[model samples]
Target chain A: MTYCIGMRIDRGLVFMSDTRTSAGVDNFATSKKMFTWCTPGERVVTIMTAGNLATTQAMISLLEERSKSQEERDPSILRQSTMFQVARLVGSTLKEVIADSSPNGQTSDDQFSASVIVGGQIGEGRPTVYLVYPQGNFIEITDDTPFFQIGETKYGKPILVRTYDKEMSFEEAIKLLLVSFDSTVKSNLSVGLPFDLMVYETDSFDTSRQKRIEQDDPVYQSISTGWGDALRDAFQLLPSYSV
Target chain B: MTYCIGMRIDRGLVFMSDTRTSAGVDNFATSKKMFTWCTPGERVVTIMTAGNLATTQAMISLLEERSKSQEERDPSILRQSTMFQVARLVGSTLKEVIADSSPNGQTSDDQFSASVIVGGQIGEGRPTVYLVYPQGNFIEITDDTPFFQIGETKYGKPILVRTYDKEMSFEEAIKLLLVSFDSTVKSNLSVGLPFDLMVYETDSFDTSRQKRIEQDDPVYQSISTGWGDALRDAFQLLPSYSV
Candidate 1:
């Protein structure tokens, strides 16, 4: 299990993903789930994946290999003209991987299925985010729903639903995502630190703001502990119920 | 789908359950999920259920009918010697209902399966809570885990995990639960308003502190709105991340 957030704010796109993967309780490993492909001043594409680790890795590998080869037969994700086309390429590749892994064609609940969050800017297009499903279908973020969360999402959702603001700065957005991710990490065992984070400022077409937040990162530690105390204090302030 | 919670505090026990039950998106109805049986000054038992509506309803009806009959041919939940025994009775009744509803004997994932949270005091026994599985087995809540949530439990769990205190007063506990339930109601269509609440004081052997909070209830409305504002303020108090 994994937890990933792809948020589209007025400033740009903010993405965060947990890096814990487990085949069983005894067999756990750290694996990066955030992938980035940028063409410097032209385009920046970021993806966060959740579900079957194998399926996600295979899908990402195909995209990476195709982009490196000059063969026109294999469409490169970097070659897509728009963010929508990039999302389509990602969805189809994910579908292809799942279908190839399963003996029978992939079902909606196939064990090999994976979902992806693709978000970034292409040329002069507006920055956006899309939640690509395992079935090769996708939906872009809207003003009403400015963020997308996939995998182990519930424990951390209430805070996001209440606190998300589209006009938030990249720093504030990272703070918000970290708080959300901290809630998830505390409540669920499958999603653990260190988390991979990427902040793509619209029109920058660069991925230099990417960072891996380790378990002992000072800022993350402070936010994690501080948020818990803040929550308890907030709970204390609510009006009490009486018979 | 449903959301129900049974929490044990030093003051005694607190229970809250949402009443929205739906067969499909277009088909929904209000139904009680909390049930209680008490012999004043002697014993009191409360059960909150989640899962297949038919299974839970049948199980509750069986308990109600058997407890009303004086015949020794059938066991009565009211006659249970202790709260533990009451939980066992509830679990077996739930398992029996699921078995009867399905053609083959019930499986762990059987659609006819249901789970129950039973808590209260019997005779001189201490008030306690038990989470009964669909397999007719149950585990009593300990000091380490003083609450039990059944069905659609995730969205509302972080708040409980962060703020729950065994020494909390009944008023504070109820306030905490309402906040948790409000989160679930706002996020899920399967769980909604008009929540049922029950508070049992230890050794009281009474179930009088029960109320159905309607959607338009003033206190609930105030808490629902106030909590969102409080949470946003809490988010702001956290330290901002810097790139």
Candidate 2:
């Protein structure tokens, strides 16, 4: 299982994903779930994946290979003109990978299925986020629903739902995502640090604000511990129920 | 889908369950999921259920009928000698109901399957709780795991994990539970109010502290609104992450 979030705030797009992957409880490993392809000033594409590790890895590898080979460049993610087109290419590639892995064509709930969150900016276009389903369908985030989360999503959702602000700065959004991710990591063993993070300022077309938060990263550790203390204080402040 | 929690703290047992049940998203109705049987000054047993509504309803009806009939009282939940025995009775009754509803006996994952949380005290026994599986087996709650949640459990779990305290007063515990339930209601359509609550003080053999918290309950409304405000404040207090 994995936990990933692609959030679109006024400042830009913020993405975070856990690296933990497990075949079973006993066999656990860390695998990067965030992928990026940028053409510096032209287009910036970032994707976070969850579900079958093999399916996600295969889908990403296919995208990487296509972008590198001129002969396959027709469907390459980098060649897409807009974020919408990039989402379409990603959906189809994910579909293709899942179909190839399963003996029968992939069902949405198939063991080989994977979901993706693709978000970033393309030249002159507004930054946006889309949640792609295992069936190759996708939904773009809107003002009413300005973020997308895939995999092990429930434990981390309440915070995102309550605290997310459309006008938050890049720093605030990162803090929010880390708090959300920390809640998930503490509640679920399947999701853990170090988490990969990427911040895309609209029209920057650069991924330089990206980072990999390790277990001992001071900022993350502070947020993790501080959030817990803050939550306890908040809970203590609520009015008590009397019989 | 449903949300129910049975928690054991030093003050005794606390139980809360949402009443909303649905066959499909568009088809929903309110139905009580918490049941209690008590012989004042002798014993008190409460059970909260989740899963197939039909199976849970049938199981409770069977228990009610058996306890009411003089001849069939042999296996009645009310006649159980201890909380452990009551759990066994509830588990077996649940298993029997699922088996009768399904053409094949019953699989743990059968659509007709349901789970139960039974907790209370009998005679000189200590207060305790048990999570009964669909397979007619159950495990008693220990100090290490003093709470049990069934159905749509994740969204509300992080708060409980962070706030639960063994020595909390009944008032504080109830406040904690309402916060937990409020979180679930905000995030899930399948779980909603009015919520049923039961607080049993150890060795009291009483069930009089129970209350039904309606959607418009003043205290609940205050907590719900207060929690949102407190959380926003908490988020603001966390240190910002610098890119």
- What is the DockQ score, from 0 to 1, of model 1? 0.79
Candidate 2 chain B: worst 10 consecutive residues by lDDT? B66-75
Query: Residue B166 deviation, candidate 2, in Å?
Result: 0.6
Q: lDDT score, residue B27, model 1?
A: 95
lDDT for A61 (candidate 2) = 82
lDDT of 1 by residue, B1-243 (tens): 999999999989999999999999999999999998888999888889999999998998888875454664343887888787788888888888898888988887798988999998888888999999999999999999999999999999989998999999999999999999999888888998899999999988888899999989888888899999988898888888877
Candidate 2 on B1-243: residue-level lDDT in tens?
Answer: 899999999989999999999999989999999998899999998889999988898898888885466765543777878888888888888888888888977875699888999989999999999999999999999999999999999999999999899999999999999999998899989998999999999989899999999999999999999999999999999899988
Candidate 1, residue A86: the lDDT equals 97
Off by over 4 Å in 1: A66-75, B66-75
Supply fnat for every model shown. 0.71, 0.79
